[model samples]
Target chain A: MATWLEGLIALVLIIGGVFLLIGSIGLVRLPDLYTRLHGPTKATTLGMAGLLLASSVVSSITQGSISVHEWLITLFLLITAPVSANMIAKTAMHHDLTPWKRTKGQELVDPASRQAPPSDHHSVKDGKLP
Target chain B: MLTWAVIIVAILICIALFLNLWRLVQGPSLQDRILALDTMYINSIALIILYGIHMGTGLYFEAALLIAMLGFVSTSALCKYLLRGDLIE
Candidate 1:
């Protein structure tokens, strides 16, 4: 392997590792469920993307062919991470889980927890159901 | 040189997994625990990919892909169950 290739892999790997660590730390230290949700859904997903990119690069060069599996994983993750996070957020709202005390936009959360959409149209209008 | 990078990243991901476990154990709410679990699986995917790179093999690709798919499914299912109190309804 060339020195530049080694450097590229190292750079990507270290950055991905750092982001992964940051996401986990945020999950542990964040004060509220809503706050904690931001960590993994965004940072960790990005971190995984970085790792997958590095893997694809390494595999493609080593195997002398394009690697499709890593790209598939990355695509699936990008599509699904948000969906899962949204579902979890909806779950939190349904349970009326409290947000951090200093969290802004307090009024919106109150009614969202109390409001039960009666129909598909209204649920879509409510902007809370997906 | 690539080996050293992979080793460093693997250690970092291991630390991340441990932190996620800590949160999973001590999370104050149901969703918090779920979030921790979700993060845990994502980190595991990273670890697996790093290991594949370290070994210079594509053999682990399927395993990583499987984990990614299953992790998302499980997380969404858990959230849905919590929201509606029913899995099939």
Candidate 2:
């Protein structure tokens, strides 16, 4: 392989590695379940994509044949990661997993505790209040 | 040069895998454990791909693909179980 191609592969590998490291660190260091979900779903998926991209490039350049397996894996990950994250988020919501104390939108998580409208105008407009 | 880069990246990924394991071991809740497990398999796929590159062979690609498919399915199934308390329902 040419020096430039080698550099490109190295660059991709390092970038993916850094993102993977960051994702796992976030998983370990984040304070709450909701926050922890951010790490693997987003950062790790991106890192995997980078790694697969590098693999595809390596296969193509070194072996002189188009390799679609990496592409297939990358596509699968990209398509499924968000779905799984959404499912996990739903599970957390179903279990009422608390977000980090500093996290906003607490009221959104539980509507009963949400503060009432200052004047009930909104409720009146919805025609629920009598 | 490529070898050195791959080595450094492999070490980094290994550390990442360890972190994932730490979370899996100590996660406070079931959802956290599931999330940690999800991350672990994905990181493993990255490691396997790295190994494949190091060996300059396409043989490992299938294994990586298999891991990816199984990881996604297992994650979804786990989440479904948590949400509905039943895998099929």
TM-score of structure candidate 2: 0.89
lDDT per residue as tens, model 2, A33-112 = 87888899889988988888898999898778787778899999899888988888777766777788887656555532
DockQ score of each predicted structure, in the order shown: 0.90, 0.86
TM-score of each: 0.91, 0.89
Residues A1-130, model 1: lDDT tens digits: 7899879888998998999899998898888988888899899989998899899989989999897779898999899889988888888887988788987655656666776444434536646656
* Interface CA RMSD, all predictions: 0.7, 0.7
Residue pairs clashing in model 1 are none
| lDDT score of residue A30 within candidate 1 | 82
Worst 10 residues of 1 chain A by lDDT: A116-125
Clashing pairs in 2: none
Tens digit per residue, CA lDDT, model 1, B20-62: 9999999889998899988988899888888899888998888
DockQ of model 1, rounded to 2 decimals: 0.90
